[model samples]
Target: MEITSVPFLNPEEYSLFCSFFQDFDNDGETSVNKSRKIDEKNKSLSEILEVIDETEIPTSKFEIPSSEFENRASEMGDWEQGRVRKGRNQSPATFHDGETAEDGGGQRRRLWVKERSKGWWKYLDSDECSDGEFRKAFRMSKGTFNMICDELESVVMKKNTMLRMAIPVRQRVAVCIYRLATGDPLRTVSSLFGLGISTCHKLVLEVCAAIRSVLMPKYLKWPDQERLQEIKTTFGSISGIPNVNGSIYTTHISIIAPKTNQEAYYNRKHTERNQKPSYSTTVQGLVDPRGVFTDVCIGYPGSMSDEQILEKSALSQRSKLGMLENTWVVGNSGYYLKDWVLVPYTHQNLSWSQHAFNQRLDELQMIAKDAFMRLKGRWGCLQKRTEVKLQELPMVLGACCVLHNICEMHNEEMDVELRFNLYDDEMELDSSRGISVNALQARDGIAHSLMHCK
Candidate 1:
């Protein structure tokens, strides 16, 4: 038998034919010829078809059970490929009984057991989940968390109430307060804790108020008799010199205007202009030699001098508090209430032959000044910022004194030796100077009496 062959068209001829026949509706084998022409217009399609001609497709409708097909595909490492390419119209040769296509992807579903050994479990154990996850897990909003914390705090204050609120509230509040006390910037703290900046600021203020209300009265107070004795005992233990002279050390009240542009400019020209300035309120405090504070008063205008403030101070009403009349106050020249004030120990009382004695007295004053400097360095200078109000002043000063006492008690090895040597030198100088030993003794006796009475 003789086979007829069709002539193959050149590329240009095929292109022209496809362009013409793309819109053609010719029927029968002529249409198939036109389709062939369109396909041949692209050389890439021709090359692809050449490769496809070399491959084979299965002719029979063969049935391998789904399980068996999956096992075979797994062995061949084509299970994922098969699933990805498989069509919905064509029944798949393999099936996973409980598995579904996870979001129409190549990924296969398996039994998810929430394995505690891997993945999220590590983060969960470390409490290191992201904020979103934490919020979801705790079933809380940020506002809800704050409200819960407030509720817990209220319960803690009530004392007699049952713990109806959750414990997480207390834990969260403590964490918030700790961050605030560390002086972390509100914005940074808020971002870290997933809180608003305003919320963080409010939380800090409220927590500070809570601490002041709850802890101040119980832990901080004026130096009563018991506290004075404690202070005296502490001084004696470290200094080896008992506090026999318990003079009242009164601090001057000076309240300048708060730092501002106007104040700064006014201060610069005050002397030149001979300007009288407006002042804030005063802060008055009475301290002992051991730095134990008592009998604090405030609220006078700052324009008043130290003498005026002291005269009006509640310290003058010693008799009302059962305090003695003979208590001498060691103060600066501003407090020269001749009968009541003891100025810095004077050297004028020494005789001409007691030259070395005056020098020795000067040395003792220098040592005391150095000790005061050290104490000032530790406790810091008293400024308007440290003074709160009249009633609150005692507690503030008492807290500072307690801290000073702690340092004196625990870290006084060097200070004690220095003070002892200075005291001995001064005592020798006092004898040589023909200083009124009887009067000095009497003053000391009065101080000692006051210390004992307190």
Candidate 2:
């Protein structure tokens, strides 16, 4: 038989393959060796046929998978004679940076492993990224965002490891802010940032810690004596009440049930309002005249009343030390009346003095209330059921408060669409009269002055 061509094997490779067979001789071989050589040659031939058969079989993945390809190759008449020629060139699958490709399923091909595509964060960081878009995503203006990055750069900046370069400080801050701003899960953040889920989670906690450590002292703290004088004067001018130190209020931050103490986090007020089981942690804040937080007490159980959190706060300790002597931070009925703390008369009375006092104090309390509203509205993570562990809530929430102060300081107005209505249930105290005789007398004096003097 004469061999002119064989299907599949390319022409250039066939000459060398044929020479190997041409050089072999069977004359000196034993019977067992002869048997082995015949079997090996037959096996090789069968394997070649198997491969050709696979290519010829129809598959939905390819347009021409059947005899069309085989017909293009030579007939069996040429292949049986031992001639082999090169197969047609196939379009190779696309590759990226040495990574695999998303090939249409081919039998011999390995499916590509894809890296997560980063979409949102890139758009946010680009030059075309509008300040409005940036603010919408992060709930703060670009200047405010840059300021935060600059403040936290020293603490939050990362070092590159041998495996991969570290995420930039800005990105770390963005991850934390995005998670807080959108209240999205870490997996959602991971997809947006093209980061691993665990990496996103770690970044959030680390950046929040950095914010608490570095920015909190500067932006969110007890106002100094000079600062207090300004706050009191401004607050007095607005509310018609003298020596108004700060406006105090408390709000609940919804959260998932903690692993160990689930019942403690259960929020009865919110659960009742929503007509379903709900859990939360409390955030008590005291804001000055400008709706910037002067002090914040965070991460107490939702079950704890406003007064309970207040008792545990540094503001309470400051009062005891007489640092807040002769001045009052006004609260709602949720808190007891005290020398440093003032509550409006809870009793029903026709007296003009009591009515005027409650009205003025309630007006003053709105400063803290509005501050909490913006805090939750801006950092949406505080408004939603956060996925972070219970122990981590304090730092995360504390960071949110600090950021809130910074935005307020920068006069960053929240987008109108992002405005959140706050509804904090205030439980009326059992007794309106507090233990402090001085506080009771002082309340009377203020109430009389408001009605009679003003």
Candidate 3:
């Protein structure tokens, strides 16, 4: 008798093989231990043949009854071998991560639960989900989501599934926007939205870029003459701030320290918040009287002064070229005084007219502060440290402003509690010098006009 080459066996088969030998040994030690010690000469030919017969019988019918097998083998295999490999065809009776495979009927099944998949989308569609919850998760109402989806579906819609099934455009956009609106970490967004972290990160940039490309021109722009006049009327009614077109301000959006030019993004002001060096980027914006952004200029380093940023802004260039002819865009003293751009009077020895002029300017300056407060409040992502890369931060900022405009247009009610509280730094008086002579005359003229109106 001889042992022949054996084919590969499943864990059950392998376990049965070991069990057969154990049963034979346990039944009688002489059949196992004594047989191994017997010399060839002392062993009878009949005994050798009997031993071979017993071994051949089990090997011939290697398959055991299903009743004979237990799940212990799978458990032991996992404990001893570290991980138990399962057949691709096996289906788990119960599924979750770190779960052990179980024998179901005649088939072995693995408990493989896919992570970051399902649940959220279905919950969003269900009646059990509340509008408040939806707004908290998505930062917009269902109507707004559907509205945006209709506009952006063409660009972000999936056309092919060659590599893997693409996530639906609505979910992709919702998850990304939720992340941006909440400023949550990628993992937090992934877990909450039921998406892979990498997928969340990719979709965030994809959706943000899509938003900027599609919505920027429509929502965020310089108002047309009619709209400008409308805005001017609103400002004029505020405190006789005549010919007022828009109010400009610079708000800082926090970001992680950049890999290159780390110092450039480092925010000198945020250092005291955590008692450590921090980084942020300045978002210079000009808003209409309704607290909607009309002009947005992002991507400047945090360390740059408002004067420097305004000097380099397209609005400044346009003003210099008479694009803003006979318009008054008021700003805080952080900005330099120009004929078109007006800032509050900063003289220590101020007359009654000058005081009245500064008072009116201060009232106008609240527009910028109120605009920023509402913008950050409505979209909380801007209120905290954003995790986007420096190169992509401008696009993210632009998309936020675009959405802010959308919310304003649709009369989206802001969450008062979520609004960013004004810090002392936000209230700091600007020390920029050198007002233009023409700009000085303009300020004095407005001041005298206010006095006469009084």
TM-score of each: 0.35, 0.75, 0.74
- For candidate 3, report its TM-score: 0.74
Stretches of candidate 1 off by over 4 Å are: 1-212, 224-283, 288-292, 298-301, 319-321, 326-329, 338-341, 345-454
Q: What lDDT does candidate 3 reach at residue 394?
A: 87
What is the per-residue lDDT of model 3 for residues 1-454, given as tens digits with 9 covering 90 to 100? 3335644555664565555555445645665555563433234434544554556444555554455345656655656755535332354343322334444445555433465556877798577988888887766787888898888998888754222346788888887778767888888888876777898898988989999988888888888888988999999999797888999989888788888998887777778777998887888889887889998788998877787888888888888888788889998877778889888877699999999989988888888888888778777788777767778888888888888888888877776677777542543445555657888888889899999995
Could you arrange the candidates by TM-score from highest to lowest? Answer: 2, 3, 1
Q: What local lDDT does model 3 show for residue 401?
A: 88
Lowest summed-lDDT stretch of 10 residues in model 3? 92-101
lDDT of 2 at 194: 84
Off by over 4 Å in 3: 1-117, 160-164, 272-274, 424-433
1 versus 2: better lDDT goes to: 2
lDDT of 1 by residue, 1-454 (tens): 3334433556765565566555455555576777775566555456645655665544343444689778677645644567533432232222212223332443433332221122332352244666444333322233443443554475333221121222233434543443422334566656555445675555544544554455335433555667667655653443233332233332322234545433421222223233465334444444444443344454554444556666777665653565634434444333433334443334467443233322322332343344433333333323222323343444434433433333343433222312211111011112243434554665454434434442
Q: List lDDT for all candidates, in order.
A: 0.41, 0.80, 0.76
The worst-scoring run of ten residues by lDDT in candidate 1 lies at 420-429
